[model samples]
Target: MSVEVLSFGCRLNAYESGAMRELAVGAGHAGTVLVNTCAVTAEAEKQAAQAIRRLARERPGVSVVVTGCAAQIAPARWSALPGVARVIGNADKLKPEAWALDAAPAPVSDIMAARGVAAYPVADFANRARALIEVQQGCNHRCTFCVIPYGRGPSRSAPVGAVVAQVRAALEAGCQEVVLTGVDIASYGPDLPGAPTLGQMARRLLALVPELPRLRLSSIDPAAIDDDLWRLLGNEPRLMPHLHLSLQHGHDLLLKRMKRRHSRADALAVAARARRLRPGIALGADLIAGFPTEGEAEFAATLDLVGEAGLQFLHVFPYSARPGTPAARMPQLPMAVRRERAARLRAAGAERAQQFYAARMGEEEAVLLEHPDRGHTEHFCPVRLAAPAGARGQVLRARVTGADARGLLAEAA
Candidate 1:
């Protein structure tokens, strides 16, 4: 094993893992394992720690370097763990010099003080049908429940030229789709000169790279939708009509407590506008089931918002308190309560998703084949091809024949 990166977290982390692999191999480190951890929830942290212990025991002598959000936030904890050779912070992961075999055990700096965004140019994602481009890094917001700010530091965006070049590289590498991802994509360009918005970046990228077949954006804050993005939804044919919103809760008070910028009305309006512009667009969201100080009514409002917002794909997270966050200091909910509410929310989301897939039955869609026999439609709905659809990474049109709890069943049309 030359280099293997165990990535945990968002699409941004997955993209970075590729860069880490490249950096590790280039640094002459073979049989090395890098664990990229997440700091989003306590469970995520626990899993990372467990993996580290397991790797040490099973692999014995392979170098185990911990990096990413979890490592950045608490380097001492990971450094103390046995068999951990080195701990790299989020700020230094992409730097080639940082991975030097003879370097110190742990080299972490003040993440909040870091300002510049470094470009990690990945030629292609290993065996991925689509490529992901990290347009920006870090978040500026101090959401009471989020530890990402500390883990990732301040928001910084890559220059427009660098982003365009990355997309060009992805396209030239035979990738059909490219996804623009970041910590807070909506907060892009604020730290740079001229203050370009994410919408502007998307337009520039699409206009400059016409050969690019499809483009998608990862989770975006509801409060950050600008006029330019709305125009893309209304006009850009190549831009996929699917968006995953970063809406933490439904009730205004709970959202306020979470320090989220968008309200219930704002979320509803954004979903409505997206559909109005692009008919039959799929709207997905990230919703937390139980937050600190959340009452029964607050949780109920979140369940109702799924219908009111017309959300089709729901990423439900049961709130897990992280140390040093404002929410963690507040009155807490029982562990059982959080898990129960999460299940209920997931059930509701499943019902809505089945309805959405059922409605697509008999319609023709251009599905991007991620697997020989499976693919995802333009709306991001999963489809199982009736026959092998050529090869992986080929996009083909298929007629939806039926719907199941999993997704749509399609045959070559």
Candidate 2:
């Protein structure tokens, strides 16, 4: 008779899921299952649908409430799913009244008309060691291959004071690390008064909540990185030395087709700048393996960029065309070709990751323990302690002892 939440997609969605669970449980919606879905790809939507059906079969009488990008974009479609009692939109999902026992069903409003990011303060992240704060919401740019804007609405930023308060709350709750996340985090300021950039917000947050030990950012668009953020990367020791860029493709032509603002050269330069500012910074990127009209040479360019950009952690996805995206109407690559290319890109990334881990041997790293024996370094590299390090959420300094396919082996320093 307890409420449960199932989340898919980005860290932002995961953060929202935490808020949704609180709202549902607070409203006495016991025995309900909240499904926070993703709509990043056609495959993602299909998988969510499959999971929903499975949940219905396994838990016969549990009321299933669906929300998130998938539900927001197509409310009727998700509402029509089996065992679904209600389908809330992203706009209404976090509101306290939405989960009320007598609240109206399918309370989806116009997401595009939404403005301002509300501070959804979460005390803890269930079992997570790091807390995620949504500093921004939605996207202003319409990438040819993306449908997130329609699901998440326009770009809006949480006020600096709210961000600081959230970080302070997380620190008080014993979270050692906090990650600032959003849909297009780099597009964080335009809608706000005075238009304070992401860097300015982060700087202010750190200054206000000085006890916050570590600060990290989710994926950021390379083309929009503000100067203040770059300065923070160079000077702020608390800011983790990990940068994950939203560099979808490495070929200029493919990037242009995707309507990405940054060129391949721009991505490379950003990577270079990060390394220069924060030496030995671990870099990560999101690279699509096969987009519509991607040729063998174009795929090779991306494969090569992994090495050139020194990306140690990679999130590689084979292109899954959304039905209404501009990419869907272009000359599409075969599914097999897409999958094969994705595999190859993954292999290249894996090799580079191994090399990066090897280079970290004997270096001292402050590890934030998510479990008694496992944690992640400031570089965001996973570490397994030779023996128990400490309790979850404890930050301990460790020296890298060895490297394995999974990550690094460490000993408390």
Could you give candidate 2's per-residue lDDT for residues 102-168 as a string of tens digits? 9977568999988888677986555668999998999989899898999999989999988888888
> Which ten contiguous residues of candidate 2 have the minimum total lDDT?
118-127
What are the lDDT scores of the predictions, listed in order?
0.89, 0.91
lDDT of residue 87 for candidate 1: 90
Position 170, candidate 2: lDDT: 82
Off by over 4 Å in 1: none
**All candidates: TM-score:** 0.98, 0.98
**TM-score of decoy 1:** 0.98
Model 2, runs deviating above 4 Å:
none
Candidate RMSDs in order: 1.1, 1.0
